[model samples]
Target: MSFTNKIKKKGPVDIVKPADEVFDNVYPTRISNISYESVIESQKAVKEFEDKDRDILIKNLKSAYEEVFIKIIEGCMLSDYIDTIYNNLPEKIKEDFDESKCISQLLNSVNIYLVSSKMGGDKTSDEREIPSDTVESIVLSKKELHDNIANKKFEEANKRGKLNNAVRLGCYIRDTKRYFASEGFIQAKASSIHSFEDVSEHCSIFLWVDNIYDISKKNDNPSFEALFTFVLLHELMHLMMDVFDETKFGINGAGNLKDLGQLYGYFREESLANALALYLCDATRNDALVYSILDYFVEGQTTPYQTGLLYIEKDLLKKAVTNWMKCKKGKYLTKQLAKEWLLEVTTESPRQSELTRIEDAIATLVP
Candidate 1:
């Protein structure tokens, strides 16, 4: 009955190899040639298909839709159900529920959710260990004051959780500066090595928070809700590509789970990750946050590689947007059924947002 099981598509193994060296979110990692050129060439071939191959595109489209749809839902903070996210629209944002605007709002809101760390890292909820920084918000009302101050602690203690001091402190300071969502660290490995499944058959995320925190602190301009949200969605996209690559890659092929098929180009994974995040943002019509995240990558970066990846990401996102905008079913995939699935999951059983994250923790602690 779970949408995850229904939608998770392993597809086929890709024969394409990655380049020997590829940038993984600015850091270069070694990979074989099962990579960018291979992926693009295969795609170009399929895209150039004659009318007879149009059916192939349709099947690919359905597969891609389901894959990304699962990713979006998984990224969402479904508490019992995805109850009313974006309820507290920023006062600065105009009151309009048009599709584009709503998408922006959702993107913005989720970053706020992420930065606030309100989602409670990896489901089981041990976010409270981090120190709260909502000390003196003159603006927060009594309830707002309590919620903001009370945010660091998870409402439950059933999970084995570890706190990343630096990341949590960064969020704490930022939270003190802004009365937004709380922040918490998930059970991802701290590395620059971005891989879906490591040699140990474990899924890991490498967030060099020190580096990211450095980038974060550099910007004097206060608006980065989009950038933050984009980063979170980007990580989620890795999961999508790792588990349901054919949905995005559209290459009718096969590969081993550990094969770094998606890890190609200078910033191949990152560029595509950003593309997927942007697509989900558009599909949901979370326009404001969409622009917020895009604008940062577009105009706000200083690091040479960051700037370079943004340039590359723009093109990647453009290709995805074009396909998605033209494909009505893709556009409606998540939006039309989000609320329904939310209700179903909430009523049937509270969906586990990070089963691997949870299982890993249990194994690590219990073993």
Candidate 2:
């Protein structure tokens, strides 16, 4: 019998549904109407749990966690492949899993679990149970999500390239938009391109196709889809930073503010953006690509001159997050004890200079 038939024979406990069903379940929401406010509130709530009564804090955390799951369910639905994967979960785990958290986290957790299982990595964790309020705020109705996908322009864009690449790009844009949106900002546009100059302010993303291919060529590996995915996430991080800075820090406060007469100010907002982006990227599914990128950095491998920007890009991301997390606990440079915290968190590596450059670049870009 065919794979589908065999999966069907395995019964309801087997999550071997058709790809379309899986896709639908994964991408259930539209790109519009995703607000940063909701995401901030969720994160803030997570932080606030520290001050709440223990029982209430756990309840609240569970609720916040569920919001992540709802996002995943929506994502799965959007990819049109919900049925194939749902049966793979244990009945108890599935029963306890919340369906209302940000679909991004849910999809991410599922992807991580699956990938880990396939690689013989640990996959014993249960789906995070979140509160209904958190879940409700993030979840979109099935009909609403389907309608949004139905209107995507990429359906046309996909028809223009090699079928597989086109489809991959299409899904990349869709998922990336969802990823950004889940963090609380709408993506005005997204596209795959040949260079950074092709990046547009109006569009939220510009995936560099040629650059990706060049990297794969250098690595002598033809399959660079995973690498490309990492790049896409990096770019998306820039977009997220832009949005968060504008909304949280005010227009003047967004980006680097060194020229604005602020001393040692580049580390605050920019660092936070980098940190959040990295955290989200790391937390998301398909992180092996991210791991590979980090591995290259750890090994001190540099890309060709033309491709050096990619390393800079990734390094800045690492620096941004590290700096941001430090800032959060009042350990920024302005804080006399910041260096101590930094030493505790990071290893003695040449990457520190790269992080400084990234902070400098952010100041230039935002100013």
Candidate 3:
């Protein structure tokens, strides 16, 4: 009946795509950090297989892949030795499909571990620069926003209002904490893990903020500023991931296995989003703010969203899994937002505007 219901019927198998397309470039964790010069030297050192050893090499490579799968089943990400084995396999030895893709998927799982909480973007980040928002631009945008809001053009006003706030905050953080580079950030708005857009010569981040009103609020630990700022920084990093690395995003078309051959796709965008948020929190030294998110990010509260619906509070994933399991072909699928029954704060009557609903959901999650 609903989109979330359709997904639950499909299951999680289609949730991930092969890393060669959706993931960051060749991040077979084993070789992710290996140097080009070293790779070159290794290439130079490749000796031709002896006639007898040819069969041995293929057997060994396939055998190693078998063992590798076993290790993966047990959750062990053995390093670049994986890359070496895959590359050494002659083209004819394997014919059905990619045996290595699963390995890459499992290896890239380490991307969760591979990113240092303190690391900024690579050199390309330094080279890309963000254009500063001038005071005139900021003032003009705000005035226009106020008029639009006064006229009840909320959607249009929201678009203009975020730029000044995002740009100003981004400039301040880059100057002090050095968490992000000087450029390649975008100011944007959205309700979910959306993708790319160009803004001020940088990619725009489409993250949802619970309360745009909280922009001017000070040091509210679990408030909108804390949540919005962190999301802002995280999305900027995602833009960079697109530029320089294979995004750890996954791909699973709607038909489930009907389209398994597709490659290079969307991030479990939220996975990278949460990861980036964790690091940005550390970089900003905002303990209380980051701790608030601990229930969701560090504790792995995201799996619930895979059902493609929304919820709130304890046992988020567990509830989602249960609901998903109950979903049936003939029944009307039920996917409820945690506060679907709650009254909108922006309204006095028992009615919810679409914006009110989105904002309320954001408040529930971010707070």
Which candidate has the highest TM-score of all? 2
**How well does candidate 2 match the true structure, expressed as C-alpha RMSD?**
21.8
In the order shown, what is each candidate's alpha-carbon RMSD? Answer: 24.8, 21.8, 19.3
For each candidate, the alpha-carbon lDDT, in order, equals: 0.29, 0.29, 0.28
The C-alpha TM-scores of every prediction are 0.27, 0.29, 0.24
Model 3 TM-score on a 0 to 1 scale: 0.24
Q: How many backbone clashes does candidate 3 have?
A: 13
TM-score, candidate number 1: 0.27
Where in model 1 is the C-alpha error above 4 Å?
Answer: 1-71, 74-201, 208-214, 221-224, 244-267, 283-288, 299-367
Model 3 residue runs over 4 Å out of place are 1-199, 206-221, 244-267, 295-367
lDDT for residue 342 in candidate 2, whole number 0-100: 25
